[model samples]
Target: MATDKPCKNLHRSPSPAQCMDHYGCIYENNHLITLLVDPENGRIADANRAACEFYGYSLRQFRQLLICDLAADPKSGVQEFVEKALPAGDEQSNRMFIDRHVLASGEPIDVEVHTGMMKMLGKNCVYTVIHDISERVSSEQRLRESEERYRDLVELCPEAILVYSGGIILFVNKQTERMFGNKKQELIGKRIEDFFNEVYFQSAEHNKLKTTGLLKERFRIEQRLIRRHDNRIFDLEISGVPVIYEEDKALQLVIRDITESKRELERAIRLQEHRHAVSFPLDSKAVLEKLYIPARTLSGDFFLFHKINEKQVIGIIGDVTGKGITAALNISALRVMFMDSLLSTQNPVQVLNDLNLKALQYLGEDYIAGCCFLFDFGTGLLKAAGAGINEFLYVPRGRDCERITVKGAPLGMFESSEFEEKSIPFESGDRFCFYSDGMELLFNSDELGRDYGYLIERFAGAALQDDCTWLGLNIQ
Candidate 1:
């Protein structure tokens, strides 16, 4: 039951020191405890029922203790907190402070201490209220650890991470400079839509396209912007999503290099056309297949098959190191050298020496390394020789392979390294093969799924699936 009580100032009896626990006294009793000190000295002050429960100290026990005696911290952490919280000029006021309290049983508890100034019996005094907030400290520590873990995860991603809001960049990872060629400081607060093409920027289509992963289709366009420092345009593709940021929607973008993908697509298109461009004149016995894999857009392998005489057929096979249009150009020059030297019935070695000198005159010292093999099908005799380019050899199983060694220094290596020749007999049904370093490097990846090498082997001994020339030399 609850009752309205007369005010203490209205001639009511002085309040008892013990907690009343009655409804009328509940609010005051919650923060009050009896004073257990002697009258004159004010030796000690009793804690209230709420304070007793808070500090795990009994009212009688608390009344025997002084605040100064209970507050001395044996541990440095507590003392440091008290010093920062309770500076000078803070004694008599209702100062908010944190302190450590050692109870009668010697257990220490952390507290937020609130002090109130008071005057009792014409003596100056202070009433203190202690509240525990240990759970808050622990929760703050856990929140810090969770934030650190999230930071570490963001740092470890291989691609460049960009955090933005409302199309303006807010944060960027270290890889951003490598991918976008811009410093993080220069990028923040910059509109991300500036990087998008005008066609996609008008309707914010680039921003929407990433959600569907379709913006990558315009990776070709990103190649246009050159970096300020090196003038090297990045072959980068970006994917991004919109998220709530600072209570508003922001976008996060991630970028990856797609240069190799662009090159592969170009090569695929060229190879499709090259397949029909080169072939033997008349069909013979063996099914001829050649696999041509250029380390770049073009390759170093070239061949030509034509009638040398009324009854004789001539065939040539060559491998050149270093590629692109340059190596392809050297392959073209080799054909010219073969035509010029072929009329003399000279050895394959002489033809290459002539070609090497021509390549040096045309391409300088960095031109190419190569090997050339020729066969006169009328006599079934095959002659082979080479320059610096090796690891490329022919293996003709069940018959003479006509193995050839890299003889001279790579064609572009020296102005003059002698070309030496070797010969072997070729028979019907013999198969010869050549390969580039990219062919063997195809399988060197952590991801062990289908790869370039796996696809090449599938066409092995059946028919080639690569872009190169296979001169079919057989009897009609």
Candidate 2:
């Protein structure tokens, strides 16, 4: 070890030789990879034991090589680093550089080099401390790759995705660009509230709560948005979740277009209303009145009255097993079949049996609770058959009301279902009411009455949980 130069003050009584020996011992035995380089020519003047072992090179071989020989990039050698690291005053300056270095084994490794000015044998030199940062660099590179993959997934997503911070748009996916009719470059850095109507913000307080970190959980809401290109307003269902994006708290919004769905809903409402608005045959002499109330936009309850001639009318009232479009479709199919069955036979028993066969073929597992009745003004007799609806209200002239029940299984349950038929004598000034099961709230067997007006008033005020339909026939 060369120890001619004295070290900085170690103690009061330490001699020059003793200080030099102490400095050499620490420098050579240090655990950190250290090197002494000639600042003028980028030559490696000396290397510590740690440096020799780390680079897989002997001390003599390291001394024979220039500093640029170890550098992965020859342009960023020690001389350039030392010149940039020189201090303005007499004070020693320290600088840090991240670069790649090649080992004696010809393997490239990432390194963080800390350089400072120093003197060795009365010549200016640069003392460098090297730290192997391969692991840290590898971790950062992996993180970048993961972020890139996440961005690709977001871009390829089917729904429109938007990321915003403090109500200012930070990012938007390709679907968002297509939905808003705007380029991503035009949308990014813009305010999110500009495109959406007042429905999105709701109130100033809601907007504040949304932009701030107070709302952290996922939430969904429907709002109207205007396209930037054509200014066309459309409905959108937006679901938002709070996320950490680019080290900042942001809201990631997933949006779905619900414009077509809303339109279909409106069309269904109109069709259901038209179905409820029943038009009785003008040629029929009997006074027929009905009240149909649906709990939802679509009703499963249905009633149809077909006037056979001037004195005879055949009618059916039923409730399908389920709700919504499926039930509505079943009701329509059954109505068409009922009309066709009446053409073949006006008998209540044959009409119901025909309908049961059609229901089994068309309805699959679904069923219908219904009653088919034939009223004959010519014979002054009413014939009724029950499938699932087993009861009817019978009011005789100047006599007490009676609950007439004809019991049988609902349609579509069995291939050979046997329905029971009932015949009752009727006269002038008597009345009858046929209703679906939804009217059970007001009319049980014991509550049979002739006052249809009062029952309708009470039913109008009640909270209906299902579809209700009732048809009244006054014997005129």
Which residue pairs show collisions in model 1?
A: 32-48, 33-48, 292-466, 292-467, 388-410
All models: lDDT? Answer: 0.54, 0.80
What's the count of clashing pairs in each model shown?
A: 5, 0
Estimate the overall C-alpha local distance difference test score of candidate 1. 0.54
Off by over 4 Å in 2: 1-12, 74-78, 81-91, 120-123, 196-200, 203-210, 226-231, 272-476
In terms of TM-score, the best-performing candidate is 2
After superposing all C-alphas onto the true structure, candidate 2 shows an RMSD in angstroms of 9.0
| Error of model 2, residue 23, in angstroms | 3.1
In model 2, the number of clashes is 0
Angstrom error at residue 122, model 2: 4.5
Best by lDDT: 2
Models 1 onward score TM values of 0.42, 0.59
Report the C-alpha lDDT of model 1 over 34-153, residue by residue, as the tens digit: 333322333455555676665577767767665556664654442343334345535444467766667656777666766555554455555555676667766887989996896677
